[model samples]
Target: MENTATRLADIHANIARACKQARRKPEDVTLIAVSKTHEAPAIQPLIDAGQRVFGENRVQEAQGKWPALREAHPDIALHLIGQLQSNKAEEAVALFDAIHSLDRPSLLTALARAMDKAGRQVPCFVQVNIGDEAQKGGCPISELPAFLAEARAAAIPLAGLMCIPPADTEAAPFFAYLAKLAADNGVAGGLSMGMSGDYETAVMLGATHVRVGSALFGVRG
Candidate 1:
């Protein structure tokens, strides 16, 4: 197996190549290595290799592994890439630098209150259920207007939009549509889209941030 540094280098190379194909600069895309379910010891090598941004699936799990890690690696940025419960809003605000699952009005309200209480405003991406999947957690397409308005009114800083295109499906059209939604909604921040399998196509279609897991860390065993 490739060492962490070698794998990190390879992913950077792929991002660079993808940026070239899109006629975009490599710096324009942010890579959040999804470290969910991976142990802390396994993560240090990548941190040692200078990979700062990481994504986590749950607040409690993140709290468990990250406190000590961030203490040792203060510059590391933690992003919440999973569904956020309203009850965890305060903890989430205290822990994550950014959140990618601001999908509902209740969560929006909770986050707003938490941000105010914490006296810290963290950037958040409003997750869009672009595929209208029944099992997914995102604001339905028709609800975007009201949902976005609620988010802004509550003073939550917006970081554009986020979506998970249907698995095993052609993702380009969904990416393109997401880009259009962001533009129409006047979002000036990043589009959090694509995972390990389709990040290159996402970058081409205007994804500003890619969440990569297995490609960088190998399959989640």
Candidate 2:
């Protein structure tokens, strides 16, 4: 538990240093401890150490775990950071505080209807395929303008942009491109880029939220 606390502090310090270098405030950055695949016992230590925000990769997995955890700690905010199925829209809206994998118009329409039905508009980050990887789950960059317009027309609360850059490539340019795209398109939460390995670079390039897993909980087994 103590070691987990120390790890959290180290990540916080690194984020602060990065924020300072970028002329940004530490408070501007939200650290989402990615808890996907980690059991409740493994997660309790970070919560015990004052961590309150967490991200999960699947709706069913989150549904199975978070209800009991939230019963004990209501302040935790859950984020959906993985690909979301259109059929799971309402469940996702009900279960998460933020949805970071909104990549298509079909999902957008479903989420809009779900949010209206549930009366809970969870902020959504428009996932951009910064690397243009066909295997990834973001909208193609060429479609961003039209896609974002469609989201606005459907009344989805835009939470800026999110991206997972090509693996092994320097991530800074991709991060910068995301920031620029958000600014150019008037997309609004802030950038949700960066992970455990390249979060400092993400922060430096204007990420408003950083999703970190291994850096916080150690490598997932």
Candidate 3:
């Protein structure tokens, strides 16, 4: 069995190699270890090994795991990486440092209410359905300007954009398009693109954050 330290070291090394191949400094990319579906026991070792940031796909799962983890590791930064429902916005806003899937107006309104109630502002990424997949959740790229304007009016801090490229599509173009969209919109800070398989390409195209799960934790059971 691979020990936690060794597994973390191997994952870090792979990240370094990926950064080098993209001609990017390793520190330029933020690795968001997706911990959705994994139990606290499965994650505690990595936390002990010094990983302070994690991503979760569901509010309930995160709520379940975070209290214990937060008590144990006060410095951890939790991110919400899944499609968020309007009703769950309050819980998500209170828990996550960053919300990476702001796809609809109702969700945005709920988040705004949550933020106002909490007296805090949460950094958020407007998810762009770059592939235009009917099944995906995101504000279509064509409607971004209006969406962003509304978000701004609501005082939600729009930090950047997040996108998932279509399966079977080359990653470079998709990443480049995300970068371009962010640039064109004057929000050039956060590009949360790429995952385990295409992160190197994403880094090359200017992804500030990459969500990696299987590549770091091995195949999910």
Candidate 3: clashing pairs of residues? none
Query: Model 2, residue 104: displacement in angstroms?
Result: 0.6
Worst 10 residues of 1 by lDDT: 212-221
Q: How many residue-pair clashes does candidate 1 contain? A: 0
In candidate 2, residue 134 scores what lDDT?
86
> Which is the winner by lDDT between candidate 2 and candidate 3?
2
Q: Give the TM-score of candidate 2.
A: 0.98
| Candidates ranked by lDDT | 2, 1, 3
Per-residue lDDT tens digits of candidate 1, residues 49-124? 9999999999999999999999998999999999999999999999999999999888999999999999999999
The sequence of per-residue lDDT tens digits that candidate 2 reaches over residues 1-221 is 34899999999999999999999999999999999999999999999999999999999999999999999999999999999999999899999999999999889999999999999989999999999998999999999999999998998999889999999999999999999999899876589999999999999999999999999988644
Clashing pairs in 2: 159-189, 160-188, 160-189
Residue 184 local lDDT, model 3:
92
Worst 10 residues of 2 by lDDT: 212-221
TM-score of each: 0.98, 0.98, 0.94
